[model samples]
Target chain A: MNKNSLKILEKNRDPFRSVKLTVGITISIIFIFPIIWMMFVSVKPDGFMTTNPVEWFTPPYTFSNYVDLIMNSLILRWLWNSLIVAVITTILTLVITSLAAFAISQMKFRFKNTIFIFFLLGLMIPGEATIIPLYEIVKSLNMIDSYAGLILPMIASPLGVIILKSFFDGVPREVIESAIMDGCSYLKLFYKIVLPLAKPAMAAIGIFTFIGSWNNFLWPYLSILSETLYTLPVGLPVFNSTYSQAYVQPMTANAIASIPVIVAFLIFEKQIVKGISFTGIKG
Target chain B: MNSKKKAWMQDLRALPFLLPFFIAYLIFTIFPIFKGLEMSLYEWNLVRKLEFVGLENYTEMFQDEFFWDSLWNTTLFVILTTPTMVALALVLALLANLNTKLQTFFRGSFFLPSILSVAVISFLAIFMLQPYNGLVNTVLQLVGINAEPFWMADKTLAWVTIVVVTLWWTVGFNMVLFLAGLQDIPESLYEASEIDGATRWEQFRYITLPQLIPIGRVILLLQILASYKVFAQILLITGGGPGGATRPLIQYIYEVGFTKNNLGYAATMSYALFFILLVLSIIQLRSQRSEGK
Candidate 1:
């Protein structure tokens, strides 16, 4: 090898590069192992978790856990309930958050910054801390075991406003003013003029909201008393207690419940990345 | 005259747009926070009559040993989780920044567990850590070690398990943040440092670390806040087992408010958590302000 190529190769061969790859691959395996292991156990025999300690990779791979879980439990019903709650919450959240974002970012109003700052306080107050009061509020409104109880409390989200507002802020003033000069109504300016441009941001907000609502356990567990209305996160625990003996079977249900969001995340990973980075930047 | 009328119309136009979310936020989130503060001062149990016992609940909370224990446990959790997750994420981000063919693959792989629900992650943890014929114990036994320590049932291990499972479930997010931060750092700085014969560690310590501080603050704040909210996973995994060693303030408050039907006292404990978070919030906002934004 020539001297210059030798030097280039040697520099590239610095052990840190290899070390980084090794560590990266190793940690990635560790991170992903839980999900993969869950999938494996989900397909394993019902009683095999306790009985068959050895032979993890060999002989029997069964579909009994998935079958039994589907037939015997209310997993699909739980999924349906979660879907309904998440979809409704996502739609409502989109409307409210986008409108609020538009007003805060685009419009001229008195107390605009002050009102926006007030909403920012909600950023510090997590939903968990308010569970007790929220429970009482919902129960007093007779919303227990109902869809409204699940969906309403979630509609007043703050992050979407922040993210979408930043995006809306980027829309040039000239565009809005030109639209106004053409005698466009404010509502038309928002729906027709602004929203299409903010569609990517909307998608990011929507997926985040949906995944959030889907994964939420605390609120649904507190609000929904009936089995029929239980979301997946809440429902899985009850199933765990009910079918305490069949450990592997419930894991099948667990895997099933986890699939939608994981898939959603995988499919929308680019937008989700943009969303996450946007949040970090705007923070 | 016409300008004044148009400005008036503009103000009204903005209100309708803002009001839907504002009204809901007022009722559910904002009002409840204030109500929670008020509830802390009273002795209004769910079933019992509402009687004014001003400051008694707060006083009782101070003297309450269980309250002390839970608060300690929560602080322990916050201390353990936030730094470990953030540091691990920084490491993963550094490694992923190596620009290999496997970069995207490893990034996505590391992040996969994070998108799964906490309940799902907790259940998976149980399968691996079940003390008897569990995957981890099985593997350990195969390697000639007979140590199958009670993972969740034991007090200390339950704490460790919660933190570890939490790391598995959440480090992806912080890793993504660090990756973003790392990418934002200009490549020219590294090139300049390399030309100056700076070592890898020096470059990272000086350039990368300094650049990451702002995002690091955000991650630290978020991780602290998020770790404090940890409940369902622990509730299912440990169930505050081995004598309430793993119970956080949230779960503790949840039990008091709902299971015990002592909503007032629960709200009192909730107020304590709120004040603690209020301090955290102030620190966070202060950090944001110091960043000149």
Candidate 2:
């Protein structure tokens, strides 16, 4: 508690501080090394890899792999497919789930508890387990290999509803009562009042939904029979298999595949981290 | 009766809002569950139902050697990944949580891989672990380990590649979860403990570990469930090869259903996986409830 002792504690921390810094820097390099290496290799000449004790960045590097990837491969199309599917799925999931959440949270509804529980039961049913029947249903509808098959089924996961509903529940009773007193329709109240109030939760769920749809492989892989219909995750594997012998192209393909997500992460870093912890704690 | 009728009329307004999600949930999620069960009872294919062979698929599944092998493989993956994931996540979280200038950098780098698609990570695994020219093998050779292991060919090494790649790809999310939990722990507890002259180890043993239990439990269950669903990474990295040593149940189901054209049998295997998950979930819920009491 004395000033001299406080100074002594500070002095003791000096050595430990450097130790901590060293460890942190080392671990961080280990974590980040793969992606950096991938990027470096993608640009390096294919023959350059033959060097013993491979260097991180010896350049005679060229843009040919990236150029070949863009010119020859269907990666751009797959990226487009991934983009539209993820964006549409995120938007639809948020809108539909928020509506349901608003009704469940703010409205006096018969079978409300039953409907809520019905959706919650979905949390138990992993999508992987249901893929067989789901495929059957989609095929029966003749929607296979189509964007509808990719986007629509992905919109209905129950997690968004559960997350949004909890957020909606936090809206004060008086707020709803006053809105109703102003003769506001329930729909307007949801759009104007509740949705705005729950923007942070919405952003979290939106990021999660986007990421899930973007990374979704199994369903899209199964349903999409056409080469052009493939999302990034599905398309990349087929590309990898077909071009497995080549080094630079496939590695460059991986780098290209990651660019969108990495950029999104850098921009929405806080929201993505919050979204992950939100799903974990809340689930 | 009149008041009840009025309440029903009042609740009708909710229908417009609830209908869209419910309809999708029904057709996509709820319906497939029962439909999968129905499919399991029949001799079906990708295109059509072959015949109703009630419980035959299930019975055959019980006897199927590949089914057992794949199931065991999946369970092995779960065992290999879960505890290591927790411990590693905890350590990364603590390191990131340190009062350092590079805290954000630590968090970002650790989490960056997790945001990537499975395709990207799997490709990196194969690329980095290439026997002759890959980063990992090259690095090992430099360190004087001359026997450069073929990462995806040898069975043990294949398993190691899958497990380590999986951990590297995923452990970040759990680390973030633990970080959130750590931040939630009241600083006063640590301050008070320090006043008691508790050593850092003692403080961590009692305060930090105990406070992390709730999030830790959540992470454990989530990790187990996730590890059971392991498919893409293993498939891409190993292709479940080395004579199918790493083939998971989901991959097996895919082969049976799509590749082999036996949907009925595949559906049966899916049910087996579902049952394991359901039981694990029930156990988790039961324990949580008992603890709550």
Candidate 3:
């Protein structure tokens, strides 16, 4: 939106600017169309969706689907499960990764390179590859169907550690040394000094972890046999699947599941984009 | 001052810092990995008594036609999706990068689907692509296609539907990467080319295409691994349906393991999946090296 940024490109002054706008609008519509259509359908009553599909906005909208979804299923409990897992995962990831990152990047630790490389190994290992063994491990430890089963494994995100480590490394060494000279303990230095300065980095990592945890479905779906333990993503689909007749309630469930994530993205759009690009470009 | 003893204590500080993640990494990732490998060598589901049958599972993998079928399905998916996503991502990135006031809105809207969970997107897409009563088919009918397409039911079209859904759900991330790459191309280069009377196309060819290639390769490599790993969306959308028409390898593995209780065989399939990804990882590393970054 900055005029200054626009001034740098010669095409900004060209007559083709309108062409760009039209094309941009078209593509934007395509990208957001699914969610918009889902929301549109969510509010409409049964049999009205395909009748006048084009007139998506002109609605005698109802909250029937939402009411049906809530009344029929353990949706509120599912949402609660999602919230606890997401929040606890975020807190645990931040606490653990921040400390490890500090040591890996900031301190003169033994086998530092080896430790960092060990974490890097995780980057290549996909969740699908590990889930088979992890299932058995969790089962053996009697953590299955517990929040710990979900939260504990998710805490050791290698990317979070690397992101924070790189951020911490950029902090001047003198900043830490000066704090140490002032009789700061190592733990105090982490909480009171390094962490505060790394707020943007922390926010980025936190949002990423929270979003990842919130949206996680496969592991939760596989491990949680009981309806009481279902997270939103895992629970919503099963709820949706049984509604083979009308899509209204299903769309409502999806819309509700999607809202928090979209809201989070909207609130931290810049940081989220920066965090993603950071993972790509500088990862 | 006890500085010598203090220095030793200070050096030990890193241990406490590193403990939590290391402990977690050990249990979740490291332990599961070895367990998966070890269990793959056994002839045991969770219920049965364990029998050490090394490489029997491996041989069964080679002999099982379902394994080959699923692998082919996976390869087909990767082929169908990766290039289309890469090219589409580039085009979208270019359009969004156009010097305009609506750039931020365009970027955010385009990236919106990437924020939603795959489960949400898959169900929403199913709603969109749902046969004669679906929005897409309704539009097709309005436009004069008499025989309405069964997007998820027909075999070939099911693949197309899955690919289209994948593109919609994920192309945003790739666009963001490419956009980052595009912006990194100095405006000064374009400006200089314009001064030398280079046409817009010429400027794009000389400056834009070359600069975008490295980023494109990296994104391509990523999309290959990611596309092959597609599961949740496909699982929900088609349920690998129309009689296993849309079943990718991962779904097959999941079904074999849990539904049929063939954990050993499933783990064997998982190892095969891991090997394929490992090869892709090597190619990614090689491409990065070639990019000389």
Best by lDDT: 2
lDDT of 2 by residue, B1-293 (tens): 79989898777888899999989999998999899999999999977998999999988999999999999999999999999999999989988987756888999999999888999999988877888887788888888889978888899999998999999988988999999999999877876776888776787899999999988887898788888888988888999988999999999999999999999999999999888887776666565556561
Model 1 C-alpha lDDT per residue in residues A150-208, reported as the tens digit of each score: 99999988878987898899888899999999999889999998999999889877867
User: Could you tell me which residue pairs clash in candidate 3?
Assistant: none
- Residue range A172-266, candidate 3, lDDT tens digits: 98989999899998889889989999998887778777777887877898788888999988887887788865778788888888877788778
TM-scores for chain A over all candidates: 0.87, 0.91, 0.89
As for candidate 1, its clashing pairs are none
TM-score for each candidate, following the candidate numbering: 0.94, 0.95, 0.93
TM-score order of candidates, top first: 2, 1, 3
TM-score of 3: 0.93
Q: Global CA lDDT of candidate 1, please? A: 0.82
Candidate 3 chain B superposition, TM-score = 0.93
DockQ, each predicted model:
0.60, 0.65, 0.58
**Tens-digit lDDT track of model 3 for B164-264:** 88888888889989998998998778767766888777878999999999899999999998877878888988998878877889899889888888788
Worst 10 residues of 1 chain A by lDDT: A49-58
- By DockQ, rank the candidates, best first: 2, 1, 3
Which run of 10 residues does model 3 chain B get worst, by summed lDDT? B42-51
